[model samples]
Target: MDTSDVAETLDHLVADATDHHYSPYTRFDWVDELDEQQWWMTPDLLSVAGTRHARELDEKQLMRLSKWEAVNFFSLNIHGIRELLIEVTRRIHTPGFELPSEFFHRFLGEENGHMWFFAQFCLRYGDKIYPDKSLPVTTTEEDTDVAHFLVFARILVFEELVDHFNLRMGRDATLHPLIREVNQVHHDDEWRHIIMGRKLVGLLYEPLRERGDQDLRDRLDLYLRRYITASVQSLYNPSVYRDAGIAEPFAFREELLKDPARTAYHETFFKRITGFLSSQEIISGSPFEGSRV
Candidate 1:
């Protein structure tokens, strides 16, 4: 993981960011209400999609679930953006991060706009934004290199997970125009972040690998795998199910989460990040194996 390998890519990303800048505030036309009959999210991307639980729902229930799930999706974005912002801000001008600091400025600004829009969508349409339930990842004080790698690796993992939804919903014609536009805007910006984050995470992980600190590496691997699982589990929010008028929301959540169809869907969607991590030797093998509930 030579640092020089990413300098040119970072410079190009900065140029692209500068050239394609937009004010997220005025980018879309908001309405007093979104059509209830319209799909807020693509049906295939729903948490319970491909499960027997989804089949039990009528059209109205499915649409209702879509609305709440879309809100949950945006809420996840708001929280994820906040965490990434804090992590990137901590490293922007710090030691060992000189090369990508320029792009960090653009990344922060774009992500702030992203947070605002996501919050706005959730509050205006759903009448509330769900609270973040993600557990914090704490680092030991002795291993600054490990801490640094985890910061960017978590960012990469997060962006990769969210981008799957963004890219799909962005192009999905079945969804409302507002939903599509919002997703497209996020998808456009996140592509750059994902690329930059992947390179930066790899660069940050090199020092730990070179030091041959097997214990630290093992710790990082286990934490990241758990983080990945937790990230996916957040999608099956019981609150979303209850808000959608589903009975026995908690049980529904548990059932859907452990559904084999949902598990396969998770693996399919998670392939990119998992493959990248394995290829980089950041983890030993497929993190999802025996990791899900």
Candidate 2:
């Protein structure tokens, strides 16, 4: 990667951003078509779907959990997109983002639209947004290279994490049509963001990689692995379990994490992102690698 390469990448991204222009206002049909008795997400996609716990659940209770799980998923999307909006917004015209300002504006607009739709789903269906239980962690490394890498990495990984669910639920016939549509729209929007994010991170990291600063590299990798783990853990909101009528929500979540089946399922969410990052040599080993989580 050279200086010209970075410019060429940014130029392409700007062109793509302009070509795929969209308006937040007309993106989704905002009418309330939710049925009270419908499964919000596919049953097989639930965290407890394959476990004995799901077996023990009656149809009514299972649907109850599905509704809450759907709400929880959308709520998490709201939070993640909000954070990304904040990250990109602050950098819109700042020193680090000037050259990419045009694309960043587009990125910010898309994120704002995503937040609106996601929050809209939670509000119309679940009646409120779920409180974010996922604690955000930041790297201690103070270098500009690490900070630049961290911001893009966070955005890219969050997209990867949630898009796994989006891609699955979007195509799943068992979920409500409205829910599936939402997922489909979100997955479609994130495809562009993911492309831009990956390129920026790869370009920004070239200097660090060239320097071969092992300690800084290790620090960044460790932060990413932890962030990956946290992203997976965010899905297991105890409040969601409680609202879904699961007893002792915290204890249940603890036990659920220990379930080999659930762990394996969670691992699937990271497979693509980890594979991409590793192939780029951005990371050596992923947090979701066997026995790592």
Q: What pairs collide in candidate 1?
A: none
lDDT of 1 at 67: 97
270 in model 1: Cα distance from truth in Å?
1.2
- Candidate 2: residue 8 lDDT (0-100): 72
The model with the greatest lDDT is: 1
Best by TM-score: 1
C-alpha lDDT of residue 92 in model 2: 81
Clashes of 1: 0
Over 1-293, each residue of candidate 2 has an lDDT whose tens digit, in order, gives 34576567767776776887677667767766576577887787676866788899898888888888899988988888888888788778888666677778778877888888888889988898998877888666578767877888988999988888899999998877778889998888788788778778887788888897898788778888888888878877899899988999999888777677776777687888898888887778868656423
Candidate 1's residue-wise lDDT over 179-272, tens digit each?
9999999999999999998988888788788988898788888888888888888888999999999999999998887777777788877789
Score each candidate by Cα lDDT: 0.88, 0.81
